[model samples]
Target: MTTIGDFMLGGHAACDDLFAQAENAAGDWPRAEGALGVFRDTLLEHIAMEEEVLFPAFEDESGAAQGGPSETMRAEHQQMRALLEQMADAARAHDERRYLGAADTLLMLMQQHNMKEESMMYPMIEAAAGTRADELIAQCRAIELRSAGTCTCSRHGAATA
Candidate 1:
Protein backbone atom coordinates (compact mmCIF):
# COMPACT_ATOMS: atom_id res chain seq x y z
CA MET A 1 0.00 0.00 0.00
CA THR A 2 1.49 3.32 1.18
CA THR A 3 4.92 2.90 2.67
CA ILE A 4 7.07 5.93 3.52
CA GLY A 5 9.19 4.97 0.55
CA ASP A 6 6.21 5.13 -1.76
CA PHE A 7 5.03 8.40 -0.25
CA MET A 8 8.42 10.01 -0.62
CA LEU A 9 8.73 8.67 -4.14
CA GLY A 10 5.53 10.43 -5.12
CA GLY A 11 6.83 13.66 -3.61
CA HIS A 12 10.04 13.38 -5.60
CA ALA A 13 7.96 12.97 -8.71
CA ALA A 14 5.96 16.05 -7.78
CA CYS A 15 9.18 18.01 -7.35
CA ASP A 16 10.26 16.87 -10.78
CA ASP A 17 6.97 18.03 -12.19
CA LEU A 18 7.41 21.49 -10.68
CA PHE A 19 10.96 21.63 -11.95
CA ALA A 20 9.85 20.67 -15.42
CA GLN A 21 7.22 23.37 -15.40
CA ALA A 22 9.72 25.98 -14.28
CA GLU A 23 12.20 24.93 -16.92
CA ASN A 24 9.57 25.17 -19.62
CA ALA A 25 8.74 28.67 -18.50
CA ALA A 26 12.40 29.62 -18.49
CA GLY A 27 12.98 33.38 -18.57
CA ASP A 28 9.44 34.11 -19.67
CA TRP A 29 7.13 32.66 -17.04
CA PRO A 30 4.89 35.43 -15.81
CA ARG A 31 4.12 33.26 -12.85
CA ALA A 32 7.67 32.07 -12.22
CA GLU A 33 7.57 33.60 -8.75
CA GLY A 34 4.45 31.70 -7.76
CA ALA A 35 5.83 28.58 -9.39
CA LEU A 36 8.97 28.87 -7.33
CA GLY A 37 6.87 29.26 -4.23
CA VAL A 38 5.07 26.05 -5.06
CA PHE A 39 8.34 24.28 -5.68
CA ARG A 40 9.78 25.56 -2.43
CA ASP A 41 6.75 24.54 -0.45
CA THR A 42 6.66 21.09 -1.99
CA LEU A 43 10.38 20.50 -1.58
CA LEU A 44 10.42 21.75 1.97
CA GLU A 45 7.47 19.53 2.83
CA HIS A 46 9.18 16.49 1.33
CA ILE A 47 12.38 17.17 3.22
CA ALA A 48 10.40 17.67 6.38
CA MET A 49 8.77 14.32 5.80
CA GLU A 50 12.13 12.62 5.85
CA GLU A 51 13.57 14.74 8.62
CA GLU A 52 10.52 14.35 10.82
CA VAL A 53 9.54 10.74 10.23
CA LEU A 54 11.12 8.54 7.56
CA PHE A 55 14.74 9.25 8.45
CA PRO A 56 14.22 8.46 12.08
CA ALA A 57 12.43 5.26 11.23
CA PHE A 58 15.19 4.23 8.88
CA GLU A 59 17.85 5.22 11.39
CA ASP A 60 16.24 3.04 14.03
CA GLU A 61 15.74 0.19 11.60
CA SER A 62 18.94 -0.17 9.58
CA GLY A 63 21.44 1.30 12.00
CA ALA A 64 23.93 1.84 9.18
CA ALA A 65 27.37 3.07 10.21
CA GLN A 66 27.48 6.57 11.73
CA GLY A 67 23.68 6.51 11.64
CA GLY A 68 24.09 5.72 7.92
CA PRO A 69 21.43 6.71 5.36
CA SER A 70 19.55 8.93 7.73
CA GLU A 71 22.67 10.94 8.47
CA THR A 72 23.62 11.32 4.82
CA MET A 73 20.05 12.25 3.92
CA ARG A 74 19.95 14.89 6.64
CA ALA A 75 23.10 16.52 5.32
CA GLU A 76 21.72 16.39 1.80
CA HIS A 77 18.50 17.94 2.96
CA GLN A 78 20.41 20.80 4.54
CA GLN A 79 22.35 21.28 1.34
CA MET A 80 19.12 21.27 -0.57
CA ARG A 81 17.62 23.85 1.76
CA ALA A 82 20.52 26.16 1.03
CA LEU A 83 20.15 25.67 -2.68
CA LEU A 84 16.43 26.29 -2.42
CA GLU A 85 17.04 29.53 -0.58
CA GLN A 86 19.43 30.68 -3.26
CA MET A 87 17.03 29.62 -5.96
CA ALA A 88 14.21 31.45 -4.26
CA ASP A 89 16.28 34.60 -4.14
CA ALA A 90 17.16 34.26 -7.80
CA ALA A 91 13.52 33.81 -8.68
CA ARG A 92 12.54 36.84 -6.68
CA ALA A 93 15.15 38.88 -8.49
CA HIS A 94 14.12 37.39 -11.85
CA ASP A 95 17.71 36.48 -12.48
CA GLU A 96 17.40 34.00 -15.33
CA ARG A 97 21.02 32.89 -15.21
CA ARG A 98 21.02 32.18 -11.50
CA TYR A 99 17.61 30.54 -11.59
CA LEU A 100 18.57 28.25 -14.44
CA GLY A 101 21.85 27.30 -12.82
CA ALA A 102 20.17 26.59 -9.52
CA ALA A 103 17.52 24.58 -11.34
CA ASP A 104 20.20 22.45 -12.97
CA THR A 105 21.91 21.86 -9.66
CA LEU A 106 18.63 21.06 -7.92
CA LEU A 107 17.63 18.64 -10.65
CA MET A 108 20.84 16.68 -10.31
CA LEU A 109 20.68 16.67 -6.54
CA MET A 110 17.02 15.63 -6.55
CA GLN A 111 17.56 12.77 -8.97
CA GLN A 112 20.41 11.45 -6.89
CA HIS A 113 18.46 11.85 -3.66
CA ASN A 114 15.46 10.06 -5.13
CA MET A 115 17.67 7.21 -6.25
CA LYS A 116 19.21 6.79 -2.81
CA GLU A 117 15.85 6.61 -1.10
CA GLU A 118 14.33 4.34 -3.69
CA SER A 119 17.26 1.96 -3.93
CA MET A 120 18.57 1.82 -0.41
CA MET A 121 16.48 3.44 2.31
CA TYR A 122 12.93 2.46 1.34
CA PRO A 123 13.39 -1.27 1.47
CA MET A 124 14.83 -1.00 4.93
CA ILE A 125 11.90 1.11 6.09
CA GLU A 126 9.44 -1.39 4.65
CA ALA A 127 10.90 -4.31 6.55
CA ALA A 128 11.47 -2.31 9.68
CA ALA A 129 8.04 -0.70 9.90
CA GLY A 130 6.43 -4.18 9.75
CA THR A 131 2.71 -4.31 10.60
CA ARG A 132 2.73 -0.65 11.48
CA ALA A 133 4.25 0.08 8.09
CA ASP A 134 0.88 0.45 6.44
CA GLU A 135 -0.32 2.80 9.15
CA LEU A 136 2.74 4.98 8.95
CA ILE A 137 2.55 5.02 5.19
CA ALA A 138 -1.05 6.08 5.35
CA GLN A 139 -0.02 8.98 7.51
CA CYS A 140 2.68 9.98 5.06
CA ARG A 141 0.28 9.84 2.14
CA ALA A 142 -2.13 12.08 3.99
CA ILE A 143 0.65 14.54 4.66
CA GLU A 144 1.66 14.59 1.02
CA LEU A 145 -1.87 15.34 -0.07
CA ARG A 146 -2.52 17.83 2.67
CA SER A 147 0.64 19.64 1.73
CA ALA A 148 -0.76 19.77 -1.77
CA GLY A 149 -4.09 21.10 -0.43
CA THR A 150 -5.91 18.22 -2.04
CA CYS A 151 -7.15 16.83 1.24
CA THR A 152 -6.56 16.40 4.96
CA CYS A 153 -3.56 14.42 6.28
CA SER A 154 -5.50 12.44 8.78
CA ARG A 155 -5.87 8.64 8.71
CA HIS A 156 -9.61 8.97 8.46
CA GLY A 157 -11.68 7.72 5.41
CA ALA A 158 -10.21 6.37 2.15
CA ALA A 159 -7.59 8.43 0.27
CA THR A 160 -7.96 9.44 -3.35
CA ALA A 161 -4.72 9.42 -5.34
Candidate 2:
Protein backbone atom coordinates (compact mmCIF):
# COMPACT_ATOMS: atom_id res chain seq x y z
CA MET A 1 0.00 0.00 0.00
CA THR A 2 1.86 3.05 -1.21
CA THR A 3 1.07 6.18 0.78
CA ILE A 4 -0.16 9.41 -0.75
CA GLY A 5 3.10 11.10 0.16
CA ASP A 6 5.04 8.42 -1.66
CA PHE A 7 2.81 8.79 -4.70
CA MET A 8 3.30 12.54 -4.76
CA LEU A 9 7.03 12.10 -4.44
CA GLY A 10 7.00 9.91 -7.49
CA GLY A 11 5.12 12.64 -9.32
CA HIS A 12 7.88 15.04 -8.43
CA ALA A 13 10.47 12.71 -9.88
CA ALA A 14 8.49 12.30 -13.06
CA CYS A 15 8.19 16.03 -13.49
CA ASP A 16 11.89 16.42 -12.84
CA ASP A 17 12.63 13.92 -15.56
CA LEU A 18 10.48 15.84 -18.02
CA PHE A 19 12.12 19.08 -17.05
CA ALA A 20 15.51 17.59 -17.70
CA GLN A 21 14.40 16.46 -21.13
CA ALA A 22 13.20 19.94 -21.94
CA GLU A 23 16.44 21.43 -20.73
CA ASN A 24 18.43 19.04 -22.87
CA ALA A 25 16.39 20.04 -25.88
CA ALA A 26 16.89 23.73 -25.37
CA GLY A 27 18.09 25.89 -28.36
CA ASP A 28 16.57 23.44 -30.79
CA TRP A 29 13.17 24.98 -31.16
CA PRO A 30 11.64 21.97 -32.90
CA ARG A 31 12.71 19.61 -30.16
CA ALA A 32 12.42 22.08 -27.30
CA GLU A 33 8.92 23.04 -28.28
CA GLY A 34 7.68 19.47 -28.09
CA ALA A 35 9.66 18.56 -25.00
CA LEU A 36 8.66 21.69 -23.11
CA GLY A 37 5.03 21.23 -23.99
CA VAL A 38 5.02 17.72 -22.58
CA PHE A 39 6.86 18.83 -19.47
CA ARG A 40 4.51 21.74 -18.87
CA ASP A 41 1.41 19.66 -19.38
CA THR A 42 2.66 16.88 -17.15
CA LEU A 43 3.68 19.28 -14.42
CA LEU A 44 0.32 20.97 -14.61
CA GLU A 45 -1.39 17.61 -14.21
CA HIS A 46 0.69 16.88 -11.12
CA ILE A 47 -0.21 20.27 -9.69
CA ALA A 48 -3.83 19.56 -10.44
CA MET A 49 -3.61 16.30 -8.51
CA GLU A 50 -2.29 18.09 -5.46
CA GLU A 51 -4.56 21.11 -5.65
CA GLU A 52 -7.78 19.42 -6.77
CA VAL A 53 -7.48 16.22 -4.77
CA LEU A 54 -4.78 15.84 -2.12
CA PHE A 55 -4.65 19.33 -0.64
CA PRO A 56 -8.40 19.53 -0.20
CA ALA A 57 -8.51 16.14 1.44
CA PHE A 58 -5.60 17.05 3.67
CA GLU A 59 -7.32 20.30 4.61
CA ASP A 60 -10.56 18.49 5.36
CA GLU A 61 -8.85 15.80 7.39
CA SER A 62 -6.58 18.14 9.29
CA GLY A 63 -8.95 21.14 9.49
CA ALA A 64 -6.26 23.55 8.33
CA ALA A 65 -8.05 25.73 5.81
CA GLN A 66 -5.48 28.54 5.87
CA GLY A 67 -1.96 29.28 7.02
CA GLY A 68 -0.98 25.67 6.53
CA PRO A 69 1.94 24.10 4.69
CA SER A 70 -0.48 23.45 1.84
CA GLU A 71 -0.97 27.17 1.50
CA THR A 72 2.77 27.62 1.21
CA MET A 73 2.94 24.80 -1.30
CA ARG A 74 0.13 26.46 -3.26
CA ALA A 75 2.06 29.68 -3.35
CA GLU A 76 5.13 27.81 -4.52
CA HIS A 77 3.04 26.19 -7.22
CA GLN A 78 2.08 29.63 -8.45
CA GLN A 79 5.73 30.58 -8.65
CA MET A 80 6.51 27.45 -10.61
CA ARG A 81 3.56 28.10 -12.92
CA ALA A 82 4.83 31.57 -13.69
CA LEU A 83 8.28 30.15 -14.36
CA LEU A 84 6.75 27.58 -16.68
CA GLU A 85 5.16 30.37 -18.68
CA GLN A 86 8.51 32.09 -18.96
CA MET A 87 10.13 28.88 -20.12
CA ALA A 88 7.42 28.40 -22.71
CA ASP A 89 7.92 31.89 -24.04
CA ALA A 90 11.63 31.27 -24.22
CA ALA A 91 11.04 28.06 -26.11
CA ARG A 92 8.82 29.83 -28.61
CA ALA A 93 11.47 32.40 -29.27
CA HIS A 94 14.18 29.76 -29.67
CA ASP A 95 16.11 31.54 -26.98
CA GLU A 96 18.35 28.99 -25.27
CA ARG A 97 19.79 31.49 -22.78
CA ARG A 98 16.36 32.58 -21.66
CA TYR A 99 15.10 29.01 -21.41
CA LEU A 100 18.05 27.88 -19.34
CA GLY A 101 17.81 30.91 -17.10
CA ALA A 102 14.23 30.14 -16.21
CA ALA A 103 14.98 26.45 -15.97
CA ASP A 104 17.75 27.10 -13.47
CA THR A 105 15.45 29.11 -11.25
CA LEU A 106 12.57 26.66 -11.63
CA LEU A 107 14.80 23.71 -10.80
CA MET A 108 16.09 25.38 -7.69
CA LEU A 109 12.61 26.21 -6.49
CA MET A 110 11.35 22.71 -7.23
CA GLN A 111 14.19 21.09 -5.30
CA GLN A 112 13.54 23.22 -2.24
CA HIS A 113 9.78 22.78 -2.45
CA ASN A 114 10.06 19.00 -2.81
CA MET A 115 12.37 18.79 0.18
CA LYS A 116 9.84 20.57 2.38
CA GLU A 117 7.01 18.37 1.17
CA GLU A 118 8.94 15.18 1.57
CA SER A 119 10.55 15.91 4.92
CA MET A 120 8.02 17.90 6.88
CA MET A 121 4.71 18.41 5.16
CA TYR A 122 4.08 14.82 4.02
CA PRO A 123 4.91 13.20 7.33
CA MET A 124 2.66 15.67 9.11
CA ILE A 125 -0.13 14.97 6.66
CA GLU A 126 0.24 11.23 7.01
CA ALA A 127 0.12 11.48 10.78
CA ALA A 128 -2.96 13.64 10.58
CA ALA A 129 -4.82 11.59 7.98
CA GLY A 130 -4.04 8.13 9.39
CA THR A 131 -6.18 5.56 7.56
CA ARG A 132 -7.61 8.18 5.25
CA ALA A 133 -4.21 8.50 3.57
CA ASP A 134 -5.08 5.49 1.45
CA GLU A 135 -8.18 7.22 0.14
CA LEU A 136 -6.18 10.28 -0.75
CA ILE A 137 -3.69 8.14 -2.65
CA ALA A 138 -6.52 6.68 -4.67
CA GLN A 139 -7.83 10.11 -5.56
CA CYS A 140 -4.39 11.16 -6.77
CA ARG A 141 -4.08 8.04 -8.87
CA ALA A 142 -7.40 8.80 -10.49
CA ILE A 143 -6.15 12.10 -11.88
CA GLU A 144 -5.94 11.46 -15.64
CA LEU A 145 -2.53 12.47 -16.88
CA ARG A 146 -1.83 14.02 -20.26
CA SER A 147 -0.25 11.02 -22.03
CA ALA A 148 1.64 7.79 -21.71
CA GLY A 149 5.00 9.41 -22.33
CA THR A 150 4.42 12.04 -19.64
CA CYS A 151 3.25 9.97 -16.67
CA THR A 152 6.25 8.25 -15.15
CA CYS A 153 5.14 9.04 -11.62
CA SER A 154 3.75 5.71 -10.40
CA ARG A 155 5.00 3.26 -13.03
CA HIS A 156 1.35 2.31 -13.44
CA GLY A 157 -0.36 2.00 -16.79
CA ALA A 158 -0.78 5.21 -18.69
CA ALA A 159 -3.87 7.05 -17.44
CA THR A 160 -4.62 9.08 -20.51
CA ALA A 161 -7.11 11.90 -20.23
Candidate 3:
Protein backbone atom coordinates (compact mmCIF):
# COMPACT_ATOMS: atom_id res chain seq x y z
CA MET A 1 0.00 0.00 0.00
CA THR A 2 1.39 3.34 -1.06
CA THR A 3 0.64 5.68 1.81
CA ILE A 4 0.26 9.40 1.25
CA GLY A 5 3.25 10.16 3.42
CA ASP A 6 5.42 7.74 1.50
CA PHE A 7 4.56 9.25 -1.85
CA MET A 8 4.88 12.86 -0.72
CA LEU A 9 8.09 12.21 1.16
CA GLY A 10 9.56 10.76 -2.01
CA GLY A 11 8.46 13.85 -3.90
CA HIS A 12 10.14 16.09 -1.34
CA ALA A 13 13.37 14.17 -1.77
CA ALA A 14 13.16 14.40 -5.57
CA CYS A 15 12.61 18.16 -5.42
CA ASP A 16 15.47 18.53 -2.96
CA ASP A 17 17.78 16.64 -5.30
CA LEU A 18 16.79 18.85 -8.21
CA PHE A 19 17.32 21.99 -6.11
CA ALA A 20 20.78 20.80 -5.13
CA GLN A 21 21.70 20.18 -8.75
CA ALA A 22 20.69 23.74 -9.61
CA GLU A 23 22.57 25.16 -6.65
CA ASN A 24 25.69 23.25 -7.57
CA ALA A 25 25.57 24.75 -11.05
CA ALA A 26 25.04 28.30 -9.79
CA GLY A 27 28.50 29.51 -10.85
CA ASP A 28 27.86 28.48 -14.44
CA TRP A 29 25.05 30.56 -15.91
CA PRO A 30 24.54 28.25 -18.88
CA ARG A 31 24.18 25.16 -16.71
CA ALA A 32 22.38 26.97 -13.89
CA GLU A 33 19.73 28.27 -16.29
CA GLY A 34 18.70 24.83 -17.45
CA ALA A 35 19.01 23.18 -14.02
CA LEU A 36 17.03 25.94 -12.32
CA GLY A 37 14.31 25.78 -14.91
CA VAL A 38 13.84 22.05 -14.32
CA PHE A 39 13.78 22.54 -10.56
CA ARG A 40 11.27 25.36 -10.81
CA ASP A 41 8.95 23.44 -13.09
CA THR A 42 9.11 20.26 -11.02
CA LEU A 43 8.46 22.10 -7.77
CA LEU A 44 5.54 23.94 -9.32
CA GLU A 45 4.12 20.66 -10.51
CA HIS A 46 4.43 19.20 -7.00
CA ILE A 47 2.58 22.20 -5.60
CA ALA A 48 -0.12 21.83 -8.22
CA MET A 49 -0.67 18.19 -7.32
CA GLU A 50 -1.19 19.11 -3.69
CA GLU A 51 -3.34 22.17 -4.34
CA GLU A 52 -5.38 20.64 -7.14
CA VAL A 53 -5.74 17.09 -5.91
CA LEU A 54 -4.65 16.10 -2.39
CA PHE A 55 -5.47 19.25 -0.43
CA PRO A 56 -8.95 19.63 -1.84
CA ALA A 57 -9.82 16.04 -1.15
CA PHE A 58 -8.43 16.21 2.35
CA GLU A 59 -10.39 19.42 2.98
CA ASP A 60 -13.61 17.84 1.84
CA GLU A 61 -13.03 14.72 3.90
CA SER A 62 -12.00 16.57 7.03
CA GLY A 63 -14.68 19.30 6.69
CA ALA A 64 -12.29 22.16 7.32
CA ALA A 65 -13.23 23.79 4.07
CA GLN A 66 -12.91 27.42 5.07
CA GLY A 67 -9.45 27.52 6.66
CA GLY A 68 -6.88 25.07 7.90
CA PRO A 69 -3.51 23.55 7.20
CA SER A 70 -4.28 23.48 3.51
CA GLU A 71 -4.64 27.24 3.52
CA THR A 72 -1.34 27.57 5.37
CA MET A 73 0.36 25.24 2.92
CA ARG A 74 -1.04 27.19 0.01
CA ALA A 75 0.35 30.42 1.43
CA GLU A 76 3.77 28.81 1.82
CA HIS A 77 3.53 27.55 -1.72
CA GLN A 78 3.07 31.14 -2.86
CA GLN A 79 6.13 32.18 -0.93
CA MET A 80 8.15 29.42 -2.56
CA ARG A 81 6.93 30.49 -5.98
CA ALA A 82 8.00 34.07 -5.26
CA LEU A 83 11.45 32.89 -4.25
CA LEU A 84 11.68 30.80 -7.39
CA GLU A 85 10.93 33.90 -9.43
CA GLN A 86 13.66 35.78 -7.62
CA MET A 87 16.09 33.02 -8.34
CA ALA A 88 15.14 33.07 -12.01
CA ASP A 89 15.63 36.81 -12.23
CA ALA A 90 19.00 36.60 -10.54
CA ALA A 91 20.03 33.81 -12.87
CA ARG A 92 18.98 35.82 -15.90
CA ALA A 93 21.11 38.74 -14.69
CA HIS A 94 24.01 36.33 -14.24
CA ASP A 95 24.38 37.46 -10.65
CA GLU A 96 25.70 34.38 -8.88
CA ARG A 97 25.83 36.12 -5.51
CA ARG A 98 22.21 37.22 -5.66
CA TYR A 99 21.14 33.86 -6.99
CA LEU A 100 22.87 31.99 -4.16
CA GLY A 101 21.30 34.31 -1.59
CA ALA A 102 17.83 33.57 -2.89
CA ALA A 103 18.66 29.90 -3.13
CA ASP A 104 19.76 29.86 0.50
CA THR A 105 16.56 31.48 1.63
CA LEU A 106 14.48 29.17 -0.53
CA LEU A 107 16.28 26.10 0.71
CA MET A 108 15.60 27.03 4.33
CA LEU A 109 11.96 27.77 3.65
CA MET A 110 11.47 24.53 1.75
CA GLN A 111 13.02 22.49 4.54
CA GLN A 112 10.62 23.93 7.08
CA HIS A 113 7.61 23.70 4.80
CA ASN A 114 8.32 20.12 3.87
CA MET A 115 8.79 19.18 7.51
CA LYS A 116 5.37 20.53 8.41
CA GLU A 117 3.70 18.78 5.53
CA GLU A 118 5.39 15.44 6.02
CA SER A 119 5.04 15.31 9.79
CA MET A 120 1.56 16.77 10.13
CA MET A 121 -0.40 17.56 6.99
CA TYR A 122 0.22 14.32 5.11
CA PRO A 123 -0.47 12.12 8.12
CA MET A 124 -3.62 14.05 8.90
CA ILE A 125 -4.73 13.59 5.33
CA GLU A 126 -4.18 9.88 5.48
CA ALA A 127 -6.02 9.53 8.79
CA ALA A 128 -8.96 11.65 7.75
CA ALA A 129 -9.36 10.35 4.22
CA GLY A 130 -8.88 6.67 5.12
CA THR A 131 -9.49 4.45 2.09
CA ARG A 132 -9.97 7.53 -0.06
CA ALA A 133 -6.40 8.52 0.67
CA ASP A 134 -5.25 6.01 -1.89
CA GLU A 135 -7.52 7.55 -4.49
CA LEU A 136 -6.31 11.05 -3.75
CA ILE A 137 -2.69 9.96 -4.01
CA ALA A 138 -3.38 8.19 -7.26
CA GLN A 139 -4.87 11.38 -8.62
CA CYS A 140 -1.81 13.29 -7.56
CA ARG A 141 0.53 10.80 -9.24
CA ALA A 142 -1.51 10.89 -12.40
CA ILE A 143 -1.08 14.63 -12.83
CA GLU A 144 1.35 15.48 -15.65
CA LEU A 145 2.80 18.94 -15.53
CA ARG A 146 2.50 21.07 -18.66
CA SER A 147 6.25 20.99 -19.04
CA ALA A 148 6.29 17.22 -18.93
CA GLY A 149 6.48 16.35 -22.63
CA THR A 150 4.94 12.90 -22.64
CA CYS A 151 3.11 10.63 -20.23
CA THR A 152 5.52 8.15 -18.69
CA CYS A 153 3.11 6.02 -16.76
CA SER A 154 2.45 2.47 -17.89
CA ARG A 155 -1.30 3.13 -17.96
CA HIS A 156 -0.73 5.39 -20.97
CA GLY A 157 1.38 2.78 -22.78
CA ALA A 158 4.35 5.11 -22.74
CA ALA A 159 7.90 4.13 -21.82
CA THR A 160 9.27 5.48 -18.58
CA ALA A 161 12.65 7.11 -18.72
Best by lDDT: 3
lDDT of 2 by residue, 3-74 (tens): 877888888898899899989998778988888887887788788888988788779888987998899999
Per-residue alpha-carbon lDDT of candidate 1 for residues 1-161, written as tens digits (9 for 90 to 100)? 55567667877887888878766566764677666766777788778777777667666766753857678888888888888887778877878899889888988897898898899878877777777776666666566666656424221123343
TM-scores of the candidates are: 0.82, 0.88, 0.90
| Tens-place lDDT digits, model 3, residues 48-130 | 88899888888988887677999999999999999999999999999999999999999999999999999999998888888
Question: Following a full C-alpha superposition, what root-mean-square deviation does model 1 have from the true structure?
Answer: 4.2
Candidate 3 regions with alpha-carbon error over 4 angstroms: 145-147, 150-161
Q: Pick the candidate with the highest TM-score.
A: 3
Model 1, position 69: C-alpha lDDT score: 66
Residue pairs in clash, model 1: none
Clashing pairs in 3: none
What C-alpha lDDT, on a 0 to 100 scale, does residue 64 get in candidate 2? 89
- What clash count does candidate 2 reach? 0
Better of 2 and 3 by TM-score: 3
- In model 3, state the lDDT of residue 44: 84
- Summed backbone clashes in each candidate are 0, 0, 0
Residue 72 miss distance in model 3 (angstroms): 0.6
Q: Which model, 1 or 3, shows the larger lDDT? A: 3
